[model samples]
Target chain A: MQLKKIKSLIEIMDEKNLTKIDYEDKDLKISLEKSNISELEEDNEDGWIISPTVGTYLDRDKPLKVGQKVKKNEVLFIINSMKVLNNIVAPRDGIIEEILVKENDMLEYNQKVMKLG
Target chain B: MIKKILVANRGEIAVRIIKTCKELNIKTVAIYSKCDKDSYHVFLADEAYCVGESNPSNSYLNADSIIQIATNTGCNAIHPGYGFLSEDYKFAKKVIENNLIFIGPSLDVMEKIYDKQKLKDVLKQINVPLIESYKLKEFIKSKDKNIYPILIKQVNGGGGRGIKIVSSPSELEQTIKELNKTLKEKFDINNYYVEKYIDVYRHIEVQVIADKYGNISILPERDCSIQRNFQKFIEETPSSINNKKLLDEIKQEALKIFQFLKYDNVGTAEFLVDSNFNYYFLEINARIQVEHTITEVVSDIDIVEEQINISDGNKNEKETFITPNYYALECRINAEDPNNNFISSSGKIDILNLPSGRNIRVDSYIYQGYSLKPFYDSLLMKVITYDKIRNRAINKMQSCLDEIIISGIKTNIDFNYEIINGKDFKKGNYKFKKY
Candidate 1:
């Protein structure tokens, strides 16, 4: 996707409050999320990654610790709720600024787990 | 000892439960649908989660998800505040099986009361004043004289739906045909029952509280006769019956029904009182009722607190029970426009000028700038007033209704004002109408 076209698409999404949009005929594939990017970008100093479900925190194997560099979309930890595992991923590329929780810690839904910025 | 609780219902009732929990130093966990993100209950809870989509079945009624969230959030108890899953015995069983307390009546009370037939049978053995009921199958099989103007109701379960009044023998066959069709299509059942319908009756219900130790306390009965289409709109403490003997008889009957069911926690036994002072047993509501606030104001008893203490196995009841020395009335303010054929009106509340000052209590979740959703019940708030006399209570309630001003969406405030101002309501001589 062209930069101008993507910017216009983002503007349209913001105008209409659209969460995601995709257009493809032969080779173009794209998806944009306003809640993740636009909302989180306002607080850039500490990009807090919170649990989306109430469950027991189960850190992924070989998890990145505090002060460690991490990348966007990286699997940081897992929340096991009702026997279902939910992967908590980094919303953006950043370093592990702080680890707010430890493995096997009981977490309420939306509880802060880590800070990556 | 429930340190934390999850209010598995929403709107005003959830807010009510959360307030009660806060006072008891118990943390509250709320679950809401995506549509209810801005709901007051969600904002009031110590913690909240979006369990499912907006649909009731997907969100509030999602038993598995609700239980899972309660389990994960460390909620020691789940209070299904009236309606929804309050009377659902299976949901209560699920909560119990998961080691979480279900804050309501016992399993037997829930199971028996849910099946009207079983509850009726249980009440009958204990000499509870019950209106005679015959199953559809049995009535069809036997040769008996038909009671004119009978109430046709489903035997397996009871709901406002699947209820009709058959006036004469001419409508018996047709009423049965329609009853069977409605039962099958609406309830997926083929069983039903019929009871003799009285022409004029006043709706009275007794508020009963039982402890885990089986000590039961009955509050002075409330007259909820002011109803529209079987849905109570106004409820008042200190029933209209003047005869002390008759009132005591009704209260005794109510206690008997509660004991027979082994009911624990807070419950209400409704009755149909005829003009001649005869009362018959109606269904039992095994949860905190909507009109409990009126009884609370009059009796000076916190019913919700009592319910929590009972669920916690606390046995002290004599200290909490008090004879009501005041008269109180609750007017349900709904988001409905009476001039518009009572159609539900939903929009952002622009300004909320509820009645304030002494002797007035408004239990509501709506505030200025709150947008109401059309997916749920139309009730907006309950305006209650307390005084030493019924006339004073009624006058105070009328003034309370007069001082209300909700501008954005239409409200039934005016309709309630008319009812409170009407002669029939003051005399307590009105029957249920389709107003």
Candidate 2:
């Protein structure tokens, strides 16, 4: 396998909660394992968060207002670069646990754009 | 003037040659591999035909198929642009045997210069200084006193393949063995030669054009010292050399060598000039070079047209054309990452924003949906900038590169910026080895 593809696979393994992955091709052979991490706990008090493309996190503009309700897959914030633009979305159906980003905020790829319980 | 021509290659160079043919009012035919069904060259040509599969061995290098297509298309001539079968003497002979113009030097001339060792020996007889080499036994006997860091290069190779450096006597055998294995695998030849490696040598080449009736012209020299892995990254005309006499001597020696071989058509004579002003003959590229655009920009001459004119039986006088008021530089943008060993990256070009401005010329066939092929050279585009002064030319090139953008595949853009902004390059004090 190409070295770049291998590095990308490692990144994917680290990001997701998967036990193992294997791929084979005429010119490539790959096997990957993920480190043990806590399974995401579902909580009614928690909100859903979605990732755009994979990257790092930036700063937020403002804090969450108390008692605000947020729906699942709702637009939370935006992450961007000179060439790419990605929007963070609510992950699950829940109330806003805590608003993460401000009005004009920066974020990383796969970095928690918002806190989803 | 030639009435019709066929381009026996594909991709950017073929498209480039077609553009010039259009300007000269010469009808053009293009040949493509199956993988290049939607290539820009096909769209640009008056007519195009598929030769074979994407693999170059069955397609572009299939001289017989290409000749047959040319014959069927009623093309009177064929132009092999810089790669594939461009320098294949047998291909040239086959084309000529079909009673069509080859648009390059005769096959006999190509045979004399195809062998690197033989070419070096010939240049040596013509008084062109070259790095001295000893046989394997002689090298072993003189290891203690010989140069400390010389290159063990495959005798029949070019393009930096099958080359290794032997820094000390202890590493000589190991390096030679590895290099021999590589040469055998890549070129099917085991012969190699050793030469004194000049660390701070500048890569300079003279562009010469010859007609059928013995007329030749030496265009201005180009400094291609900014290179990586022996492949040129940046090239500029009006080299930083200040010694007029020495430059003239080098050009004269190159002309003498060309005359000795009776080489006709467009060719480049390369040299490695060291810090002490000593120049060593490198090799001759029988086909047009990748950086030929820089020479064309500085000299204001269409090299493709010149080749066609020569092939059409036009006779001209021997003369040296100098760059009048402007300097030009070219950057070869490839689909490779500098930080990752320059490995070829293949994917669809989702977005491609080519840089443009006054004095900027971008020669590329990439489009928004173009797929970067995995089977061919990784060169993606040639970005060139020109100005009246050297620094201006450099700045223009930097700005142009800044505006350029590509997605879905990695490139060497960052490395190009670093090289241009580096202090050594800014002062023009760097050599080809610095890359």
Docking class of 1: incorrect
Instruction: Report the C-alpha lDDT of model 2 over B170-272, residue by residue, as the tens digit.
Output: 7987765765576565633236667777755688899999876667788888889887777788888878666777778778877887878888889999998
Considering the two chains of model 2, state its CAPRI-style docking category: incorrect
User: What's the lDDT for candidate 1?
Assistant: 0.82
Evaluated on chain A only, model 2 obtains a TM-score of 0.38
Q: Clashing residue pairs in candidate 1, if any?
A: none
**Interface RMSD of the predictions, in order shown?**
3.5, 22.1
Q: Model 2, stretches more than 4 Å misplaced?
A: A1-117, B134-148, B154-156, B168-172, B175-191
- Against the reference, the lDDT scores of all candidates come to 0.82, 0.76
Query: Which lDDT tens digits does candidate 1 get at residues A1-117?
Result: 477778988899989767888855465567776665564753333577776655688979897778888777778889887778988777767888888887877665446778876
Once model 2 is optimally superposed onto the true structure by TM-score, how far is the C-alpha of residue A102 displaced, in angstroms? 72
